[model samples]
Target: MASSEQHYILPRPEFDKPTKVLIVISPYYKAIADDLLSGARAELDAAGASHETVEVPGALEIPAAISIAYRQSNFDGFVALGCVVRGETTHYETVCNDSSRAITLLGLEGASIGNGILTVENLLQAEVRANPDKQNKGAGAAAAALHLIALSRKWGRSGREIGFQPEGIQIAGKAEGPTTA
Candidate 1:
């Protein structure tokens, strides 16, 4: 039923300069991960964006990896890929919620992240979503990251200063030479 509904896809964003992206994947499900990676790679290629891939142990680690890369590397954006099939226990909920939350937190902290981690009812659902020929959620996620990167570039004030002013710099609206009172 949902598959029958059409969804609008935005055009891939254009960049004035070359963009670099990092794909952090949790290869817990090899086949699904491979398909997701393929889709992501294809989308990045179409946008003329450069990217590199890294593997983590599980879905929970995907966010951590992305956070580390965001701080230590110069990537313009990030794509997070993984499959979390619901299991008999509650572990599924934890993984899905925690990982999603962490990724959101990273985004709030100025990291351009596309969350492609699939939390599905079963393996079949994961497979369908990850398939490049089918849902291709990976491509959707990559598109999101690219859009975010574009927005950051558009609104970013690189020349402006943030945080505390350097030593000896006067605060704005304050007396420049001497106290009036």
Candidate 2:
């Protein structure tokens, strides 16, 4: 397949308030992981955002690590970085799909997360995508998280209310009573 020559870059988000981010990386491929981490850190630094990095065993663990950090830490956003190169076994598909789904679910739950996990057919493809001077998927993921965090702050709430509540717009906590005509 042919790749697009045009590169569309979005304006980097600027945060009014201080932003803290957590980066969860799976260091299965040390060299590739290092490149991804380097790119992500550079983006976070440029945005004037402080960040913490943690390593997981594999791509499947990246999401769980973020989830744990999300609950126990006070990070404003998260970046998940990893590389999953396809293997002869079906484990490749499982890792890619599960990790992605977990990240999406966390995002839907109001967590600002950027998925930097690369699913590639070979190590060469992964290297190209993870390279800082190449695709720089790592930096892209960090930017995604920052944008979401900015949007969340702009909206004043992280999540939306689903279904009608008996009292007020808040979804959390119990409603006092059901009032209907």
Candidate 3:
């Protein structure tokens, strides 16, 4: 048999600045919650992101705390990290929908909210997202926040004309001198 080939993928662009981030984590699943925090920290350290973490009682409390964090100061971005596994009742839907809607509203209002909340049917899937080496939802959230931070900076510095495209894939504006964000 022939030898198998290996492939490696690299992360996208990094924000080159003292990115200030606020991470709101719900302690519903304390054990797995620790992994999300650790993964977030690892990503932040690797990317030189300045971040602060706040603990919430449960997933339902995450959005409220996030709202408070948003009103506190001019943080570059926000990360909402929580885990809501399906229970006997319909509580999961409420938490997931409400929290996600809150974050979406914040983003639409020009406040970037990196959503890393895990809505899983079981603990196994939640563990997958909490895995530091595999999915690492926290790291993914950090990356998103960093991206939004960079875009916000670019907008502020470049007169707010060059904003993210409709799909947020690329920024649209006059092609001129590139400014450091």
Candidate 4:
């Protein structure tokens, strides 16, 4: 047997360019949320992305706002940033579960929503994750959304392709034109 080593080649994908995005945040933990938003804003600014940051009452409102923003069709993606710290009551569980599920469903239903909600037992963990230099979750969420958007574009779907083109320029394989009767 011949001994040989093979090198792997990596391919770089082309991005769809900077686009408008929405960041829905919860005011539950204003301090931590501020940190998260700052991190996210830094990344967006660097990428020249047009974006809006909206504050909701809590994590529960994040998803609904996201859905509304998506329906409005003004943004290419969304960042769902929130923090839920467990307390003595059941409110924590409800917020965590509902917020997470809503975000998941939003992602599944042709929406590019990055789940950045931090459900932790205490404020320290949330701070660690949301802090600009500590966790950089804001940047992480933005990157995730951007990466997903690129993947969607590469797959020939933008989560809004529900019909054919008016000009009828069907994108076919190398074999060629559309066959018609």
Per-candidate TM-score against the hidden true structure? 0.89, 0.85, 0.78, 0.78
Ranking by lDDT: 1, 2, 4, 3
Q: Per-residue lDDT of 62-181 in model 4, one digit per residue for the tens?
A: 999999988876788899898999999999899999999998998998788778888888888888889898676877787667666666666754434455555545444322345577
Model 4 has an lDDT value of 0.79
lDDT of 2 by residue, 73-137 (tens): 89999999999999999999999999999999999998999999999999998888889998888
Which segments of candidate 1 are over 4 A away from where they belong? 161-181
Summarize candidate 1's per-residue lDDT along 1-181 as a digit string, tens digits: 5556789999889988999999999999999999999999999999999999999999999999999999889999999999999999999999999999999999999999999999999898888889999999999999999999999999997656566655556655453344456
Model 4 regions more than 4 Å off: 1-16, 157-181
lDDT values for all models: 0.93, 0.91, 0.79, 0.79
Clashes of 4: 0
Each prediction's number of clashing residue pairs: 0, 0, 0, 0
Q: Identify the superior model by TM-score, candidate 2 or candidate 4.
A: 2
Give candidate 3's error at residue 66 in angstroms. Answer: 1.6
Q: How accurate is candidate 2 locally (lDDT)?
A: 0.91
Worst 10-residue lDDT window for candidate 2 reads 167-176
Q: What is the lDDT of residue 54 in candidate 4?
A: 91
Model 4 TM-score relative to the real fold = 0.78
Give the local distance difference test score of model 1.
0.93
In model 1, how large is the Cα lDDT of residue 138?
A: 92
